[model samples]
Target: MRFERCRMLFGDEDFEKIQSSKILILGIGGVGSYALDCLYRSGVTDITILDFDIYDESNRNRQIGSDAVGESKVDTLAYLYPGIKTINQRMDMAWVADFDFDPYDIVIDAADTTKVKIEVAKKCYKKLIMALGSAKRYDASKIEVASIWKTHGDALARKIRNELKKAKFDRNFLVVFSPEEDKCKEKGSCVAVTGAVGLTVCSEAIKRILK
Candidate 1:
């Protein structure tokens, strides 16, 4: 009954597809945490969440898990959302090789670290989605979902493209990025921009699985 409305929108068969699809998400910060929220409420029953960081007082402004400061992100999420088959681990690129890609329908990279983002981009086997440059911007309308090759203006996007090119990665991949340049270095990011990036990433994952 919890998902009855979802069943109405997707039909029973496609709703089953949504429930059965597996998604792996890296990072539990401003962007990834919001993405997790969207996917879980949208009827994704199988999810693998990985994050090496703990909630911080500073994260309260954007992250959903910000209240559980000093707790492991995975543990907090597992306790908060029960009954879903969630495989959560404190992981980073150092242990990325151990990840089994075969089971996942999609992999999302919302890590704030540029190195980690590039690593995920380079090694991901499943349909990959990454978010970039949601920081220092107040405008959520500038956020765009496009192929990584066509994405421009975001500083992180440019860096990722440079790294991918050197590695000879030619595959067209989806990226949630903003072309708007944030000029003020002292200006901080907010939930509005980062949450939009997260929701966009989740939407892309759902579309990929359904289509």
Candidate 2:
């Protein structure tokens, strides 16, 4: 069980600590699907999801299952994993303001929406966002992070720029945006790139919680 090393970093007595952990996987598209794979493989068994998107032909480029074309993504995952928890509604932090979300050790935003990332950042203790450079989200010499207006490309960048104009974000907070290295546009959405970013998100989660 050398692979147990992944779980051991958390602590000696918490083999299933991750199993008990509550993770909110927002969006079940390219990044969310792969993010779930990383979390599940790493022994994170408890999860809550929020997504209302039905599988469509457009999703064929990158999604969990090709057969899932006509099914609800969240429902498909629930059916597939059986034990993983799921939420079938889209997130609207304001209207759903009263809903109680238990604190998460790390919140992964594969939702592909800037608004969702901002919502999770405001609600959760820590947040991770996946971004690819297809759109110029401002010019960041390095890929680590960019302020709301710092990014120039990608759809996420535009959305963030708009949000920042409203002055809602906290500059002091730690919000990490990971633009896929090869990017979906240039590299095309390979399971390789998606899987790597997924692994990166989970790796960041481990480092944040364990270190």
Candidate 3:
């Protein structure tokens, strides 16, 4: 079955295949939450979210729900998207390493910790991963990944990617959530910026899949 909303873009074959491909999202913050909505509309029916954070009042700044106060954020996501599968636990490589899971076709990283990003990359090196996948996609337009991307889709990323290719550094999606000048931790932000990043993440995901 097709979600009418995405009918304008995803047609028969792409939608069908995408619906079957399992997606594992690693964060549930503002960016991840927004990206989830995009994923749902895009017809990715099987989604697994892993986050260990509980709702807080401060999250009202950009998180999915303020009413979810004290509730497990992942739990809230599962409820909003009924068919979604969720694992509410802090992601550690050990959790993934010891588990028996079908090799996920894609991994979306939106977790808050840099450690989580590195760990997830190590844990799921075999599949095609997406930028900093999912939530991390938000804020990436200006968020630099170690001077690689001065702005979103900058040339340095291309340079590094080419070097990695030459060195055969296992091909994987390395998306960065760029921090905008105004939203810099040096600055501050609202949901608008967070949403921008989430949509961008989904946009990149679609583009990659189309390519």
Candidate 4:
């Protein structure tokens, strides 16, 4: 009965797809953590989360598992959801170049690094829903999903777009982003905005899966 509500909402066929989909969420920070939460609660059983960083006291404000400071984010999350897989490795170009993404039905890029985001986008544009900058912004309602090419007012998205063009990456991919003007240069974040970004990314992935 864990998924009874989801079953009622999605009906039998779509709910089955939700349960069977292989999802990969990169980063276990403010945005990625909520994405994982939404997917798990919605009956996604086969999930693999990747994050190299451990929790720090500063993360407590917005990130899940922040209580386990100095502990591995992926390990802690996997402990909470034993059904999921964990990869406690950095998302560097070397790793991204070799990692196989074909196994996953959808790859959610909530990772912070722009280089890693671009590499992942280049490798798996077809199955990627990336989360753009959610920091320094307070309005969760401003968050929206759009093609990376069409996104505006997000400096991170603009940077990624320029980089992707330099790399000759022509494909357009979906991204969850807020059009709010960034408040400052400092990376200030809150669950209100980051959590909304994560949930929106999860919603987009689910919509694609059911389609």
Candidate 5:
């Protein structure tokens, strides 16, 4: 049916894996929103999106649902994708502490906050795929998925590396990052880059699960 195109690439048995997989997406901004888009269309039937933030005018340039101001991101995605679960809560390391990650097969960290990314990397029991450094740059081709330690050039990646080191968690994690430097001093984001990173994160999650 709707997943015929996906089933063509991976046979019926493999395509079933995508449907059975449950993914936890931690943000619903520029990157996370696109991740949701790709995962849902790619046949991932089970997903729980978490984000307490509402759509804002400023996010119109890159984030999905930004057109609907004041709309809850969690609810927006659930409504758009239908049948998916959602958590309307502000997430940080503190929130994840009490959270049970048992039902998920993969956790995607698309949170813009550095601490939240660190928390996901440190505490998440399921395999994690995170987005890093998708801001400012317009070239979507620059983004790549690599081990966190092998990532460079992006300021966010450097910060995450340092924090993970301090926490003494040296385990290698896959991250979608861009080596292209930020175009300006101010924090900025664009849909081209963020969307690309989001797609890459979903692709990595699917590959890991199938393997």
Candidate 6:
């Protein structure tokens, strides 16, 4: 009954695919959390979340379920969404080089670090939907989903593009980005924008799975 509406919308075969697809989400911040929420609520049960950071008082403003300060983000998420897997480790170049991504049907990159995003783009380009710079913005309506090369106005996306080019990443991958100008210099976040970005990323993943 939980996914009755989703089942109605997607039909039985596609709904089954959505439920069975293996999804990997990198980062458990504002964007990733909402993406995971959208996926799970849509009947996508098999999800693996990866994050190295612990919840902080500052996270309460934007992050979902940020009640436990100093607690592992992955652990808290796993607790909140039982049956989903959790990896509570930082994604670095070394780990990225060694890890195998063949098992996952889609990889969502909501990570804050450019290095990790580039590495993920290289390794998971065929099945990646990355989030580009959700912070320091306010307008949720400005969010757009496009290939990384076509993205503009996001400094983080620019940096990732440069790194990916230098790394000889020739494949194109979809990304959720906002073209709105930053409100200030400081890295601040609003759930309105980040949540919209996250939901957009999830929507892209759903489209891919249905295809």
TM-score for each model: 0.92, 0.71, 0.74, 0.98, 0.96, 0.97
Shift in Å, residue 1, candidate 1: 1.6
| Candidate 5 per-residue C-alpha lDDT over 1-211 given as tens digits, one digit per residue, 9 for 90 to 100 | 8888899998999989998999999988999999999999989989899999999888899987788888888888787889889999999778988888777899999987898778878877348888887878989988877889999787888898998889888998888898896787776777888898898898898898799
Clash pairs detected, candidate 5 = none
Query: What's the lDDT for residue 89 in model 6?
Result: 86
The residue-by-residue lDDT of candidate 4 on 22-111, one tens digit each, is: 999999799999999999999998999999998999999998888999998998998887799999898999999999999999999999
Off by over 4 Å in 1: 84-91
Q: Rate the local accuracy (lDDT) of all candidates.
A: 0.82, 0.59, 0.63, 0.93, 0.86, 0.91
The number of the candidate with the highest TM-score is 4
lDDT of 6 by residue, 1-211 (tens): 8889998999999999999999999997999999999998999989999999999999998887799899999999888998999988889989889889999999999988788788888887999999999999999999998899999988888988888788787799999999899998898889999999999999999999988
> How does candidate 2 fare on TM-score?
0.71
**Could you tell me how far off, in angstroms, the CA of residue 166 lies in candidate 3 after the best superposition?**
18
Q: Give candidate 6 regions above 4 Å deviation.
A: none
Model 1 score (lDDT): 0.82
Tell me the lDDT of candidate 6.
0.91
> What TM-score should be assigned to candidate 3?
0.74
Please tell me which model should have the higher TM-score, number 2 or number 4: 4
- Candidate 2 wrong stretches, greater than 4 Å: 1-11, 14-16, 93-96, 125-162, 171-190
Candidate 6 total steric clashes: 0
Task: Give the number of the best model, judged by lDDT.
Answer: 4
